[model samples]
Target: MKKKGNKPLLDMLQNIAEGLGETLSPFCEVVVHDLRNPKNAIHGIYNNLSGRHIGDPATELGLARIRDPEFPPRLSNYANTFPDGRKVKSTSIGIKDENGEYVAALCLNVDLTLFQSFQGAISQFTRIEDGRVHEDLERTPAERIHARIDEFAASRATTARSLNAADRKQLVQELKKEGLLEIRRGANIAATHMGVSRATVYGDAK
Candidate 1:
């Protein structure tokens, strides 16, 4: 009787594990690729260092001198799942064994998906009296300009099912006049977040 009860419990645990693994498979594959690329690079360097082929001894020794003590020797991955279900970012660690020593290093990347409902809710909360206010009240003049340009592009794209050339041009002019275009000139975050181009924002503004 006890064995029968435990069997069900074990089956439940296995099912849960399988479900979690299926959900995480894509992210895990990305993490594996990230780790593998750098590990291959390092291994190639090590092979050259060991005089497996032909290379300068001092150069190889110099490459070997880079070290950090806090990491580990086996590959490990860490990821964070956003509450909005729209973004996942992961870090991959590469482990190495060096002369009876273990060393590890990390590479990190972010994967983002937009959740319109979540964004709308947040934007709504930030608005005062049915009017939206700039989120970066403390930003520099240039930063504010860029932010506004990105915001305009994002707003236009989100609302328009199909924008004509004239409409796009108008949107660009409006963004530039509002000082949004200047801010985006130096930032990748604005482009990535808004899902538009630095070129589009700049060209339209111009």
Candidate 2:
């Protein structure tokens, strides 16, 4: 078995990190890990957080990929915490070669502290009536979806993940009533937050 670096693929990954970093800038950090070299797996990093540098050792996930050939390829948004106590949300994707070998990985970490602070500030400002009542204008579609999910989960006294089929249906109906499902790609977004599939979301929407 011959193992060699894939220049084209690496270049593409680098470009992807750079592009995403540019858009999210200071809030997002993108890192590329080369599985072939575990000791120095960090081949590239953009919008650096965690104060990590190129040639840094593999992360826990990177090491896991090295050990398990059947490791999941894609990891969706999940919570993380920095050493300095900053909260983060992360997603990771593993790249495989023709031989079904994990060759590289791309991970994105988004700092949530700034956004939390910003949300708090906005909440305070919104609370102060400016001579006119403005509708809930500060929250984005995703935020709204998350809020509704949280509210539903609270009502059931269970986590969103614990929502049964009936619970999900009711939650979906509530979301639809709030006009959340009417937004572009709203079903997909809501499904992701509700920990359900797009097909499930569609069924509930109907």
Candidate 3:
């Protein structure tokens, strides 16, 4: 059977490229290169994140493939860069004919800036601070109340007794929400810990 030119294979790859471009969306760039014509290799571009267009020259890898057909057919997750200096993670695949001649190439370049920023946010969210840790086993009602008070004070960089009026009012409201004030002598306990009178705690709660 006499072989056809690169059209049929190019058409098939173009379909696959369109699907991948739509599926991967804005983060990925997909480029189709017609290897037969190195100078005007870019046949089409999809999800064009790299700022390239049709009729662009083939990449160095494509040129290498043409210069030496023995070159690797696929190189995946290779490091690359955009013209704006953003990082790129890329993959390229060379398509060959029945005669094993390089006919075309498909290149996928993924924008890593978004992922890198997301990774930073995740790292900050999941980070753990060192020391000054307290685990409330709820050993006793009074202990739970006092521990929570201590934690609240520690967060404000002050001792329970040193809490100002604003801090005290906020703490009293939060303590009431947790039903800490409902415990027996809880008001007395809070008054003693904070060096305040029962009347003051009650006023803060009101």
- Using lDDT, give the best candidate's number: 3
**What ranges in model 1 sit over 4 Å off?**
1-157, 160-164, 184-190
Worst 10 residues of 2 by lDDT: 1-10
Q: lDDT tens string, model 1, 20-137? A: 4355443321211112122232221211111222121222212242243344433333444533454545444443433332232222333334344567889988977646665655
Error of 2 at 182 (Å): 28
Judge candidate 1 at residue 69 and give its lDDT.
39
The residue pairs in collision within model 3 are none
Residue lDDT tens for model 2, 103-190: 8999999999999999999998887657796686598888888888988899989987789999999889888888999988889988
Model 3, CA-based lDDT: 0.90
Arranged by TM-score, best first:
3, 2, 1
Full-model lDDT for every candidate: 0.41, 0.88, 0.90
TM-score of model 3 vs. true structure: 0.63
Top candidate by TM-score: 3
lDDT of 3 at 205: 94
Which residue runs of candidate 2 sit more than 4 Å off their true CA positions?
Answer: 1-3, 128-206
How would you encode candidate 3's per-residue C-alpha lDDT over 78-181 as one tens digit per residue? 99999999999999999888888888999899999999999999999999877869676546888888898999999999999999999999999999999999
